[model samples]
Target: MAANDFYKTPSDAVTAVNSIYFLLNAGSNAVQTPYNTLFNTGMNFMGDDENPGPGATNPDVRSQSVLGHASTGLRVLQIWQQHYSGIKKANIAIEKIPGIDFGANTKLRERLIGEAKFLRALYYFNLVRLYGGVPLILKDLSTLEEAHSKPRRNTVQEVYAQIEKDLIEASTVLDPIAGGADAGRATAGAAKALLAKVYLTQRKWENAILKANEVITGPYGYNLVQNYAEVFLPIYKNGPEHIFSAQFKSVSQGQGNNQAPRSVLTGVPGIVGSYADQVVFYSVPDATKPGGVDKFFSVYKLYSKKDKRRDVTFVTKFKSPTNGNWYGRLNDPAIPGDSVPFFNKYWDPANVSNLAESGANVPIIRFSEVLLILAEAENELNGPTGIAYTNINKVRRRAGLDDLTEGLSQHQFRDSLYLERRLEFVFEYQRWFDLIRERDAAGNGILESSLHKVGKTNASAKHYLFPIPQQEIDLNPNLEQNPGWL
Candidate 1:
C-alpha cells in the first residue's frame, strides 16, 4: 500500500501517532530510546548532582562525566539520532493524519495531529537546547534529494519559533484531561506548561508567567500530591500532579523503565542490579588516608533532616532481603566510610526479581514544575511579588519547609528557587538543563562555574551546548558544528 493510501481511516491515523510515542521512550526490540536510562545517564553525568558509578565503564559515558566528550562521542551521536528519529515519525503523522477521514469522529483526527505536533515540538525543544540550533524538518521528505537539499541548521530563534507554534496549535486541540487509557497522552495543560518552560528558557518573563498561569488556573485540575514520595510511585502513575509522562509497562520486553536497574546498587543479595550511576557528593582532602585519598562527602547532607523529600529522593541504606541485615544507616555522614546514596525515585520495590522490570514512568512535565516556572518568571518581572511567594511556598510547604524569609531581593529568591529545583527534581533529567540555562547576576554563563563548584573544572563556556555530532556533519557537510566543537 502506498504511504498516502494507508491513512484512509481513523484507525490508521491512530496507529501512526502511536509509533511516534513508542519511539519517544521505548524503541522497538528493547533498544535505547530518548528519556530512557541510557539518555538520562548522559544528561545526569553532565550535571553536578550525578556521577558515573564504578560499574559504568563505557568511555562515552565517562567522557561526558568529565566534560571531555567530543563531537564524535557515541552518547552524543545516540542522542542526536534518537530525537530526530522521533521527529521523523512525528512529521509523517502530522502530515498524513490530517488527510484521514474520521466521519463522525472529527475530534479524534484533530487530537491525533495535536499529539504529533506536541511531540515534534518536544523533540525540537531538546534538540535546540543541546545543539543550539538544528535542522527544522517539519514535513516528510519524499526523496533523497529533498532530504539532502535542506540539511542546513536553522537559527536558534527559528527553531524556538517553530516549537512555540506547534505547542500553541497543540494547546488548542488537545483535551484538557487525558483520562482512562489516554492518561499519559499530552493534555492541553501539558502544552501550556511546556510552553511556559520554553519561554522561561528564553528569558521571556511575562510570556512564561502567562502560559504557566494558564496551566495553573485552567481546568486541568493539576496540584501537588500531598505525599512527596507518592508522585513517583508506579501505582500512582499519571496521578493528579503528572501533566505528562513517558509511559512504561513491565509486562513486555523493552517496555520496562531502565533507570531503575542502572541506579540500583549491585552486590545486594537477591537483587540483580548494576550501579551504573550514583548521586554526586562532595569530597575533602584527608592527609591520613592511603595515597592521600580524599574523604567522601554525602550529597544528602545538603537536605535538612526534616525535609520529607530527602528520604524519598535518595537511598542511603537498604535492608538486604537475603540476610535480613541493613547495609547502611539512614543519613549517615559520609566522613570517610559510608555508603554512597543512590537515586530513590525510580527504584521499584516490586520488581526485585529483575530490576529491568520496573514500570515507573519518567515524568516529562508535572504540576510542581509549572508552579516553579510561575514563581521564577514572576520574580524576574515583578521581583518576588505575593504571587511568586505563594506558588513557591506551595512546593516548600509540601516538603515540610518554612516559607521564604519575609522579604528577599530578587537575587536571593532566584537562588532559592534554583536550589529548590535541584532538590525537587534530582535524577529526573532536569539538573543539566537548569545548569546550562541559568545565569548569574552579571549575565555570564554559569555552567562552567556550577561544574567548578562540584570539582569538574573541565567545563567552559563551550560546554553550554553539546557539540553537533561529527557523524551528522560527515553525512551532511552543510550541517556545521557548534562553535568550539570543530
Candidate 2:
C-alpha cells in the first residue's frame, strides 16, 4: 500500500488526515504525546507556577525545573522530536489529500486539507516558540538523498509568516463548527482563535483584536461553561467552551490522559496514583515553623480565598475511599496530607482505581482565553476601553470575583490581565509561554524576572529560547544551535 495509491480514495484521504490527529493527540504511547505528562514536564517545568515535586528525581526533569537544561537534555530532545514528527505527518497529508478527487464530496477534500494545514501551523507554532527558526518543511520528502540533505533553519519571521498563511487558508476552508463524530477536530473558530494568539504573541495588537473578535462574535457560538469546574471534567469534553482539544479516552491502552497520574500524589491509601511530578507548592516539613514547614510563594496562594477558581484548580484535601475518612487538609502537619496541593483540574474521578486510565481532554484553546486575549490586545492598542473592561470582567465574574477596579492606567490594566491569565490557566501548560511573552517595565521578558522572584536564580536572557537539541545538530550540520547553548 504505497502512499500515492492509498490516497486515491476518499476513505484513504480521511484516514490520512486522521493519522495527523492521532499523532498529535495520542502518539505511540502516553509519554510521547504533546498533551501528556512527559511533554508538559519538559516544556513547562521552568514556570514559576510549577516545580519538580518530591518524586521528580530525574535529572533531566530537575534540570528544566531549575532552568539549567542543556542541549543534550532528554526532555529537550523529546520535545524537538515529537513536534517535528507531527509536522512531517501533516506535510504528507497536506501534499496528498489535495490530489485526491472527491467527486461530489469536494467539501471533504477541502476540509481534510484544511485540517492538515491547521495542524502543521500548530506544530510549527510550538517549534518556533520553543526552538526559534526551525526548518520550515512544508512538503513530503520522497528520497533518501532528500532526507539526508537536512534543511537549514529558516528565520523566525519566515516560520511565523508560514504559520499565518496556513492558518488563514485553514480558517477559510474549515467548517465554522465541528459536530457529531467530527467533534475535537479543528474548526474555523479554532484557526481564528489560534491566529489571534499568535498575533498577540507577536504584539500585533490590531490583528489580534480583529481575529479574536471574530471568534467571539462569529457563528461558532463558543462561550464559557456556566461552572468553572465543569470545564475540565470528562463529561464536558468538547463542550461549547472548548474551541479545540487533544482528545483522549479511558481504558484505551495508549489513549488515556497521562497527566492524571503525573499530577496525583502517590502512596495515598485509597487512591491509586504516582509521584506528583509537578506541584504548585514545593515544600518540606520543618519542625521550627508554625505549620511545620516554611510556606513559600505557592501559585495557589495568588488566588484569593473568595475566587472560585482556586478550589477548582487545586485539591487541598481528598477523602480516602479505603476508610471513608478525610486524610488531607491545608497546612496539615502530616507530609503529603494537604501540606501540598495537587492539581485537581485533570484528575479523573472515574479512574479512581487506575489514574493512568483517566479520560480527560487537554484544552488547547477555550472561549475564556479568547475573551482575555481580546481584553489584552484592546488595552495595548486603545487603552482600557469599555470593550476591554467588559471582556476581562467576563472571566473575572466567572471566577466569582468583582469587576476590575475602574479607570486604571494601561500599565495597571496589563498587569491585572497577566495575573488573570496565570490564575485562569494554571497546569494547562500556558504559564511558561505567558511568562516568556509578557514583558516587564525593563523591556525584558518577564520570564527571568518572575523566576528570580520565586528563587530560580539561574534563569537568564538565554532561557527565552531553548537550545536546539545537540542530537539534531550532530545529525545535521546545517542545523545550528541557538545562541548561548555553545
Candidate 3:
C-alpha cells in the first residue's frame, strides 16, 4: 500500500509507527546495509574508555579504536543511509497522520503524530551528533525531482531547534505511560529526557534542568531499580528504570534484530569455549561484538569494593566449559587467555540456543541517566546544592557507594558528575559523544582531555564531528562536508 494508505486506519498508523523502529534493528535484510552495529561501534568503542579486545585484528574493528575509518567505508555510509531512510518513514507518518480524523478515537491521531515526531527527532539527533549539521528533511517528498534537488545542510543550531520543537510537541501529546507490546514505545518522559540531553549538549542548563526534572518527577513515576543488573535482564526490558529502548526479541536470523550480534562473544577462543558451537549464525553477523572487544579502563577499575554495580557491568573472569579452566585474569599478560573482562550488561544465556542473536534490548535511555542529568544540570545552574548531591547520591547509593562529598567547588562537582556518568553509563554509546560535545572557556571540549589521557591521540579537533559520508555529498551536491574533512 502507498504511504498515505497506511495512515488512513488506526491499525495502519500503529504499523507505520512501528516501521520507524525497524531501521534501528535493521541488519542484513536484503538491502545490503549494516547500521546499528556501525553506529554503536563508532560512538561507544571508538573512544578511550573502550578499545579492541586483546588480539583483535578486524580492520573495521581496529579502525574505530584507532579513528581511521574513511567516509566511504561501509560503517560510515550505512549509518548515513539508515538514519535518512528512517527519517523518510517518519516524515511520511508525520505528514499523513495529522489530518486524518480518527472518529471517536481522535486521541489516537495525536499519539501517533507524537510518536512519529519523537522518532524523527531521534533520527535527527543521531545525525547531528555524529555528523554535525545534516540536511533537515522534514516533509515527505512528492516526486523524484524534489528528492534529487535537496537543500543544503542546515546549521547545527537550526537542526537542534527543530529537534527541540518536535520533542517539546511530542512531550505534550504522548501519553505518560505505555505497557504490554507497547511498552517499548515512546512516552512523554522519553521525549522530555531526550530534549533535556539536547539542552545539556547546547549548554542550556536551565532548560535541561527543567526537562530532566519532569522526567524524574513527572507522571511516569520513573525510579532507579534497586539492583543494577536488573536493568538489562530480558524480564526487565521495559522496567521502571528503562525510559526507552530499541526492542529486540530473539528469533531466526533474517527475522531477528541486528544489534544482537553486537552483544555476543561466541567466536573468541578461550573466552567462549569452542566458540563456533556457542553461537549460531544465520544472516550476516559481524565478526566481533562491539562490547566484547571493548577493554575496560580505570573508570571501571575505580569502583570501590563495596559498589554493587561493578559485577553487573563486567566480568573479570569466566570458566571455560571445555577445560573447566578459568580465563580473564586482569593485568597478567603471562596468562594463557584474554584477561580483559567482557561487558556483561547485554549477556543472555538464552542466546546460546537462538544463535548469536541476543534478546537484550539496547538501551537508548534509562532513568539512571535522567538522575545524573539532573545532578549535572543542578550543579551547573547553581553550584553544588542539596538537590544536586541528593540526585547524584541516589545513583551512588544504588551502587553501594556512599554519598558524594559535600562543599565541593563547581569545578570539582562538574568533574565528579562526569566521573559518575562515565562509570554508570559505560558501553551504552555515550563516551565519545560526551568528549566532543560542548566547548570550554578556552574553546576546547570539556572531555577532550580525558580522551587524550587514555591515548586517543587521533581524537583531535577534526574528529569532534565525523565527516559527512562521501556518498551523501555525491548524491546531493548541496550537502557540504565538515571542515578538515575536505
Which residue ranges in model 2 land beyond 4 Å of their true spot? 27-30, 280-294, 329-338
In model 3, which range of ten residues has the least summed lDDT?
274-283
Off by over 4 Å in 3: 28-35, 54-58, 99-101, 252-299, 319-338, 353-355, 438-443
- Pairs that collide in candidate 1 are none
- Output the better candidate (2/3) by TM-score: 2
**Cα lDDT of model 1 by residue, 1-486, tens digit:** 656768787888888888889876784324678777756656778878888887788888888898889999988898889899889889989988877778888998899999999999999999899889999999887676876674799999999999999999999999999999788998899999999999999999999999999999999999999999889989888999999888888768668888787777677787766778876766656576454654455456568889899989987666676888666532345344565777888877788657677888888889999999999999999999999999999999999999988699998999899888888988878888899898877778778888887789878888988999999888889998888997
lDDT of 3 by residue, 31-137 (tens): 42223455455455567566654434457656756677777666678778788888999999898876666789988889988999998998899889889998899
Q: How well does candidate 1 score on lDDT at residue 82? A: 88
* Candidate lDDT values, in order: 0.85, 0.84, 0.73
Alpha-carbon deviation at 412 in model 2, angstroms? 0.7
Measured by C-alpha RMSD in angstroms, how accurate is candidate 1?
A: 2.7
How many steric clashes between backbone atoms does each model show?
A: 0, 0, 0
TM-score of each: 0.95, 0.94, 0.88
lDDT of 2 by residue, 1-486 (tens): 666767888899888888888766674433567777655778767878877776677788887888878999998898888888888888988888888888999998998899999999998998898889999998887667878787899999999999999999999999999988999999999999999999999999999999999999999989998899889989889999999988888988667887777676676676866654555454445676567765644887789989999988888556666877665534545333345677888778888767777788888889999999999999999999999999999999999999999999988999999999999998888887888799865556788878887778788889999899999999998999898997
lDDT of 1: 0.85
